[model samples]
Each structure stands twice: as C-alpha cells, then as structure tokens.
Target chain A: MAYIKLDREKCKGCMLCISVCPKGQLKEDKGLNKKGIRPVRFLDKDCSGCAFCAIICPDCCIEVYK
Target chain B: MKKIFGRTRSLRGVDTHYCQGCGHGVVHRLIAEVIDELNIREITIGVTPVGCAVVAYDYWDFDCVESAHGRGLAVATAIKRLQPDKIVFTYQGDGDLAAIGTAETIHAANRGENLTVVFINNTVYGMTGGQMAPTTLIGQKTATSPLGRNEKTEGYPLRISELLAQLQGVYSVERSSTDSVQGILKTKNAIKAAFKNQMENKGFSLVEVLSACPTYWVLSPVESLDWIKNTMSKVFPPGRIK
Candidate 1:
C-alpha cells in the first residue's frame, strides 16, 4: 500500500504534483475536481512514495502515509 | 518609487546616509521588493543588525527589531517561535553574520527553526569603517588587513552558504551576487524561495547576497563590481548551494 492519496474534490489539477514527483507516480486522470482542475491518479505498482510531490504542492492536498 | 509591491511603504523617502558606491542600498531595495511581491509586509518581522544595515529598519516599513552586535539569530529565533504564523527574518552583513553572530546563526539553522535569513556578504566590514570581515577574500586590503590579508595567520574566509546548507533545518540555501543584472535576478529568486519555504512551515532558509564595499574597498562603483567578479567570486562562486 503506497502512502499517497489526493482528495479529488480539493485537487486543483495544476499538475504541480505530477511535475514535482521525483518518481513519475502521479498523472492526470479523466476526471476534474470541483474547481475544474485535473485530479491526480496513481497506478498501483509505479509509486515509490518519495513524497517530493506532496511537499512541493502549494495546496496541502497530498497525503503520504510513510 | 515603486511600492515594492506595497512592502516598501515603510520607507519614508529620506536619502540614505550610506556612501556613494556602497552595496547596502541595493540589498535593502531587493528585500523590500521581495516582501512586497509576497504580500507579507504586515506579517513580516525583520531583525536589523548593528552593521551598515543597522538603519535598514528605518527604510523598511514593517515591524523591525534591533539585535545586538551578534545576537540577531537569538532574537529572530524567539520571535519566530512565539509568532509561528508571522514571517520572521533577519537581515545581517558579514561582520554581523559571519563574525560576531556565528554561533547564534549556526545553532538556529542547526535546530531548523522556521525563519528566513538575508545575509549580506560584503568582503569588508562596512559599518566600522572597512575593517576585515569573516568573508574578506585573501590578498584583499582592508583597514585592518592593509597589507592584503595573509592566509597564514588570518585564516581562509568562511564560505557561509556551504556551511549553513549542511544543517538539517535548512530547507533552502543559495548564494548570489549583485555584481550583474543576471545575478540580481538570481538573488531575487533565492530570496523568494527562502520566504516561500518559511510560509509553508518548511524550516529555515538562508540567502547570501554577495555585496560590495566601494568606498572602503578603495574602488569606484564600477571598480567595486570588477573587484567582486575578479577576486571575491573566485573564492565563493555564486549559485544554489542547497
């Protein structure tokens, strides 16, 4: 279980998370958040859980369990 | 006359008392501009040291605190802890940061308290009349080291950015100079990053702005820039350290 999660409702879809992710674990999904920003999606096996993306996010929307 | 994004309102437009070619003026304007762009002027608490930048609080319109010869870090540390929500920073010159206040700065960054430090690295001490500073380049002449600083006894100048970046609490660290326009932009970005990190509660951030002292260095304003490029930058190359 990767310690990564993003609240789709709150995600602004700025792609900053995807951009900042050291290990390309996140991508924009088919859906949009309430603010019309693309929400991030995670493929199960690709997550290394670096958390660089989470920390660089201007909005505190990312959660990493580890 | 621009508002520094509204952060410079604290300045009263009085002609500064600094010498003609001193770099302190440029350093002050840069800080004010950054504070304005971030819109953190009201919430920013800046500590001015006793060096040439001692009058910084006067030109900057914010809650300016005065620290003793080497106690800037201690005072800033206390303020940041109490007002966690406020943006606390310290503006200090080489004489204040590298010389007298070395321990205070080291320990504060070592502990990684949430604060910003805008360090001015003019090779010579500007306030006390061009005395030798901790960052004085080797073979450089100053009031004390008139014979050109001999590394044999005076010791090598301390590269502050590299040293501070070694600490765990330091989230951002960069060294830039005002000797050129490109360098100025780099310094502005570094300063922004320091404040941004502090805003997000990341930890301590230090930006060392390589400055010049023309009058005391016995060079014209243009010559001072040349001195910084040819001499100072060789020892402490400007770039992001951490």
Candidate 2:
C-alpha cells in the first residue's frame, strides 16, 4: 500500500496537491492548521503512489511513499 | 515502505517566507533537488537578485551572494571567472532580468560566462505589488497597466530567452513552466540541464521558468497555474530556444 505524509505545520493550504491527486484521496480538512489555514487530509484510500501531489505542492508539505 | 518523494538536503529545514502556493518555493525545491542529485551543494554558489526571491539564501543551504537589482548575472560572471572550479548560478526575476538588468544579462551571455541562470518570469512584479513587468503579456493587466498592457506604448513582452539564445556565447536556453505536474517535471529537468551544462563548462546556460503570481494576478494558486498553462503559454511558449 502507498501512503503520503503531510507536514501539517508547513502546509499553507494552497490545495495544489488536491487538484493533481489522481486518486482523489485528499480533501480540505474542516479544522485549521497551526497557520490557521485549512490543510488537506488524505482519505487513506488506495493510493497509486503517483507522487503527482507531492510534485505539485508548492510548500513541499507532502511526502509520498509506495 | 519505499520513500518515493521528500525534501532535499540542499534546502534548509525551515519555512520559506513566500506566500501560500507561491511558485518561488516550488522552484526553490527543484533547484535544491537538482543540487542534491548532482552532489554539487558544496561547490555550487548561487547569486540572488533584488526581487521577491531576494532572501533566497535563507532557503538554500548552499552559499549564496546578494547582487544589486538586475546585476545578478554580472555578479555570477565575476564569481565564475574568479573561481573556475566552483559552479556558479544566478536566480533572477523577470523585472530584474529583462527590464532593469537587460544589459547585464545580454553582456554576460555574450561573454560566454560558464554559469547557469534560473530566470523566473511571473509577468508581474510580486514583491512591490502587481506592476507590469517587461515580460508581461501585451494584453495582461497589472497595477501599472490597469487597463491592460497596450502594444502601442509598452511595445511587447520581451522574449529574453529567445534573444539570449540568438547570441553565440549562449550554449543553451529553455523556457519551461510550473503550471502542472508534467510542466513542473519538465521545469526540473530544464534546471538540471542548465546546471549540468555549467558543470561541463559549456558556457552560459539559462532556464527561464514561467512562474505564477497568484496574489498579484488576483487568482487562486490553482487558477493561476491554469492561467499559466492557458493564457501565458500562448505568448511565451515553453520550449528549447537554442
């Protein structure tokens, strides 16, 4: 199974990752992060490990593992 | 579990001051990744320009020197000439390069300085508010060009990469964008190629990256990216110029 780790504190909630995620496993969290921005949450579904989200993240907040 | 992607050691383990979804951070990570992949962090020296990325040294772990606005190429030229063994590069913005520093950039490329240049063309000035830059699209509107850039007055967006590519001193020039995953990957490859060229002493190499300025463009980060892929690419088409 593939999974992605998010550095919540560093996330600026740009949502660029959400737009690129092929699996549609990411979504905006209802809660705000340390920066008071709505961080993205992974649904823990089947991940393809494409790393597209990580590649498109402007803040370098996501790390993908397969 | 195998780690497919992560931050590079060449980048400092600190948050950048750039706004959320800023392209500068993405480009910074790409440069750091390239530095790590080439194992040149120790020998590489970056010259920072006087624009939004002026404090780029804070994010890059390697040595960096600050240059006057539009003088990044001149400083890089000097560094590369003084220390031929070291890999030198300049990180400049559209305003710093195509506008205020046009002469320096042209001269450095003409002199065939063995160096790399990472030119970020966001079309507008981001740090000091959204002002029409030399590379701004003719019809694009900015603070200075509230009614859109008029060709009769502003002439046209300066195609610096194409202009530099025409010079015999320039070895390679590519215009890449960070609009999508594929585009970002291409941009990284272009940056790596530029760095590799400098390592091989191939004379001047430049990778002009079409970056996004969401705040100044009055669009969300994602929408700004689409704008780059759709509108901006029409004018500054991404491809190898030389």
Question: Could you say which candidate leads in TM-score?
Answer: 2
Instruction: Report residue A66 deviation for candidate 1 (angstroms).
Output: 53
Candidate 2 lDDT tens digits, B14-81: 88888878899999999999999999999999999998999999999999999999999999988888
Question: Model 2 lDDT vs. the true structure?
Answer: 0.93
CAPRI tier for the interface of model 2: high
CA shift at B60, candidate 2, in angstroms?
0.7
* Candidate 1 clash pair list: A13-A38, B10-B61
* Candidate 1 lDDT, B117-224, residue by residue in tens: 999998888888889887888888899998988899999999988999998878888899877645666787899889999999999899998887777888765577
Q: Summarize candidate 1's per-residue lDDT along A1-66 as a digit string, tens digits.
A: 455766666555545456556578788899766666567787656666666555433233556654
- Candidate 2 regions off by >4 Å? none
DockQ of 2: 0.90
The best candidate in terms of lDDT: 2
Candidate 1 wrong stretches, greater than 4 Å: A1-66, B1-10
Candidate 1 residue-wise lDDT at B131 = 90
